[model samples]
Target: MALTSIKTSGDKIEIVNQLLLPHTTEFIEIDTIEQAHDAIKSMKIRGAPAIASLAALTVASHLSRALQADPAPEWLSSPQLLDPYITAQLDFLYTARPTAVNLGAATRRLKHTLRTGVEQGKDASAIAQDLIQEGREIDAEDVSRNKRMSKWGGEWLIEQVKAKGKSPESLNVMTVCNTGSLATSGYGTALGLITYLHETRKLSRAFFTQSTPYHQGSRLTALELLTLKIPATMLCDSMVGSLFQHNDIHAVVVGADRIARNGDTANKVGTYNAAVLASRHNIPFIVVAPVSTVDLDIADGTAIPIEQRPALEARLVRGAVYPFTLNAQGVKEQATVMVTPEDLEGVYNPSFDVTPAELISAIVTEKGVAVKADGASGFDLSSIV
Candidate 1:
């Protein structure tokens, strides 16, 4: 069975608690916009695309219930009353996570819908319905477009290999973090490209980093590849350089949290390290993501916000106790153990890092692949976005 991060039934949304993943499968219901915001802020529901989907769905669910209320809420009385209420909700949701541009894009898109409906002179109820549809579409469109970008990236990589006078079959690809079924609404971004290669029988093996602190790659990506029955190898984040130095890695594929207009990509922390090493090793580095991740307003990576997680998060690791400790519920007991000294004062834990456009071989979106022009340091992503 495929692993899912977000699941929806009618207006109710539930997400798999990612913190307890690979051991426990807990589905927490998101009943309100506040709950959705909290989930994203706390990292219970994460990944740029998945959190964006949740935020948009929460808005749709909120408006849906408002319409069905026995006596409609005061905010729904008219467009004048509705406009500020919905706008405020979206603004608050955007504050939950500052680094991922996808969340901001989703909110901005909804705000546009609201403004367009009002300008068209639609009544409150009609405008509410339009907003609801648009919100749902934001989530619904993710999966299909992910598959499209995956195909584009995968085929491009194969052709690049073939052009170099190498057999395209049995290519070994390395990836960072956890872009898989559990990261987005469906397929994925980088992991989707890896899956595409495997599906087309062009893959030999997939290598992934442990991605410390959160260990999303070890905990989430590992489980995902195992479920899909793909041949994979897990390496410590520190080993990316060694892996690249010794292995015939065809490419390093990663997903973007935010992609600047110059093609600079902010992704999980270790992604930059992999990109650097891949460049030294002459391996292609690919960034796969949806169009929503592209932030054209951000001229360069320096303008991109990097989220800092709690220092305590870096001091501890959560997992099932080895040697098989079982809890009363018959499941393996999971605990958070402090890996660093109790009095540890400093822990630099930034959630993501940016890879310069010069290090990137290609940036693939649902629209198409964008590459740097001859003698260019960055990509002109305006056309692709």
Candidate 2:
């Protein structure tokens, strides 16, 4: 029951509609660049890496189709004409989700490939082929890197426990949001490390927060863990502190949307709250993600741009009607109900929050694990990136 967020066949692309997860599985086709943009922006296909993959694959599909057209498109006539057209497409894709650094990284990488190919005197068709290959590679590389970082983070946690004169066996862990197979190409980020621990027989039970407004935790991560047959418990977003207080939780692991140069991490909205509580409970707080998530250009967390979701999104909840409302198809009848007052004037719905480097015990990437220098308040991630 390995769940895939995106699926592809040659130049055709499709993504699972994550909004209906845990209850329903629906695959929606992504045929055009605009469709890709809408899917990412609408959270039809989310998670930073997942959206980046969709964006890259969509670009590849577009170029591959253009190359096979009966009457060649005007933009494909020459590199001079091709450069701006492709550039505009990349720019448009970047605007789909502004907060995810991975999307920007993918687009920037493609632009560099395009520039280098043109400078090497490649023809427009050759350049198109090069761009297409690079885009596909961007999606293909996510799973392997995820596996590497999961091992790195999992082993680091075990060592940290042993150093504290505590048994590392059967460690209880808590996670903030969904970071399993449904969130990436495969494996995962933080959830991958939890899986690594379980696979190695070191995990007792995994706890996850029911991330409010999006329920990514209860819906997506819960499904992933159950599919893998891992023992897990679900708690409300408000229960993280209580879970830490009553449970011998070894660590709080989470996935990041973006990481600043000084090691500040931006993740799901409730992550900062979990980090603060973990710090108070003396629990290790780890950020697991690929290197592409790090943005060296941003000096600190304050500079990270937070995308605020629509106010209406915070006021509505979608789920199967209680008491088992089943349709003729045998699937539960789902509906979106207004949870807040119909005319509620004030609703705060920022999609992410930044956790200061001081609160984070370590950051793990495919390269390795990074910790702050002795007596330092922040990490200089210059080498890690």
TM-score of predicted model 2? 0.98
lDDT values, one for every candidate: 0.94, 0.94
Query: Following a full C-alpha superposition, what root-mean-square deviation does model 2 have from the true structure?
Result: 0.9
Candidate 2 lDDT at 24 equals 86
Best by lDDT: 1
lDDT of prediction 1:
0.94
Clashes of 1: 0
Writing each residue's lDDT as its tens digit, candidate 2 over 1-385 gives 6789999999989899999988988899999999999999999888999989999999999999999998999999999999999999999999998999999999999999999999999999999999999999999999999999999999999999999999999899999778988889999999999999999999999999999889999989999999999999999999888888888999999999999999999999999999999999999999999999999998899999999999999999988788878899989888999988888999989999999999999999999999999999899776667
Alpha-carbon runs more than 4 Å astray in model 2? none
Worst 10 residues of 1 by lDDT: 323-332
Tens digit of lDDT per residue, candidate 1, span 158-229?
A: 999999999999999999999988989998999999999999999999999999889999999999999999
